[model samples]
Target: MDVIERAVSVLMHDGLVVYPTETVYGLGADAFSDEAIQKVYEAKKRPLSMPISIAVSDFEMLCAVAHVRPGMEAFIQAFLPGPVTVILPARNSVPEILTGGTGLIGIRIPSHDLALRLIERFDAPITATSANIHGLKDPQTPDECTVSRELLIDGGRLSGIPSTVVDLVERRIVRRGAEADKVEQFLSTL
Candidate 1:
């Protein structure tokens, strides 16, 4: 089977996969599956209180798990498909664990080719947290990734930066990472 197909198969079995993005390697799990999400937390050694982001392949997929506000669409359209994550209100279907009981979710539409294809072909959103143990350095290559995963998509080295996180509702940048200035500029117009 092809790489993405294999990744999807792994996810179908509640398996974890490490995939490369424009920024860093990401640990992907079936977003809607609580079992898969729990596995991600266990693999990363992350706290249950910390929220995890989910990656989508397109606009429609983004809308599936989030309540994209009226003006938020323009913001998402601009920075997304790049190294940026936007916080949006989560739909009821989104498990509390993913949102960390905040009722809001961080979402990304990665620009990386393999990432996009994987999520697209998986036919659902997947967990988008970086593929490294909690409090560890972001992994830019396969060797750097330390998380447990069933499939590893080695896309060579990445930028080693995390996505800049933005909260449109409060009009603020959560964490400054890749393209922070550009995201700050875009948020200024809001």
Candidate 2:
């Protein structure tokens, strides 16, 4: 089957699929589906306390899940479709499971076309956590990704660098990544 159709079908069925993102291979599932979201944490052996970041294709979808404030637009404009993740207050539409019962949600529009297309085609946001076991080295290639019999989309090798994470709620820097310095600079402007 085609990639888009396969991706949508898996998400609609609340199944997990590993796909390429700008930083690494990510395990994606329906962000709104509790069962699907739990599968991601289980599959990766990730802690329930550590929330996963959701990927959106556009501003409209981003706005749906997050309470977009005035300064948020400037941040999105500067780093969206890139490697920086913005933590925003969640709207009622976002599931508590996705946020790990936290009011804040991490969101991003990746620089990768395949990643963006999957979100656009699926017509829903997806939990885009790195496809790796917890505390394990993140997979840069599809084959390296340790998925358990799920649909894996190979988009060649990915950059080993993960996205720079910024917490807007705390108005401070979180863990730094590939474009850490650049992201910090951008955040300072706001």
Candidate 3:
């Protein structure tokens, strides 16, 4: 089977995966599975209080996990499928582990073809956190990924810049990284 098929199998079995995105490598897991979510936290040695983001394939998938508030769809369309993570109101189905009790979620729709394909094929949300130990550099290549995962889908060297985290509900940038300038420009026009 191809790597993506294998990755999907891994995910189906509650395994973790290291996959490439437009900006950096991401450690993917079944976002809705509490057990799988714990594995991701353990893999990165990340604190449970920190919370993790999630990746979706398209707008419909995104809305399934998050509340697309007023005028938020346009804001999401402006930067998503590129290198930005939009913070949104979480649906009840979203596990509390992902929200850190905040009732908010950071969602991504990666523009990278492989990442997109994997999510589409998996037909479910995957954890979108960087494929690295917490407090370490986000990996730009598979070789640079520091987290433990059952599978790794290499997409060669990435730009190394992480996705910019945005909170449209609050009208602010949470953590600026890739495409901050353009995001700011787009926000200005809003």
Winner on TM-score (2 vs 3):
3
Best by lDDT: 1
Question: What local distance difference test score does each model get?
Answer: 0.94, 0.86, 0.94
Candidate 3, TM-score vs. the true structure? 0.98
The CA root-mean-square deviation of candidate 2, after full C-alpha superposition on the true structure, stands at 1.1
Give the per-residue lDDT digits (tens) of candidate 1, residues 5-121: 999999999999999999999999999999999999999999999999999999899999999888899999888899999999999989899999999999999999999999989
Model 3 CA deviation exceeding 4 Å by range: none
Model 2 clash pairs are none
**Model 1 off-target regions past 4 Å?**
none
Candidate 3 lDDT by residue in tens digits, 41-81? 99999999997999999999999999998889888877778
Model 1 TM-score relative to the real fold: 0.98
What is the C-alpha lDDT profile of model 2 across 1-190, one tens digit per residue?
7987898898999999898888988899999998998899899888898889899998889999998787778877878889878889999888887787888899989889888988999998999788989888889987788856368888998997888888887767787887889887877777
Superposed by TM-score, candidate 2 places the C-alpha of residue 77 at a distance from the truth, in angstroms, of 0.8
Candidate 1, 80: how far from true, in Å?
1.3
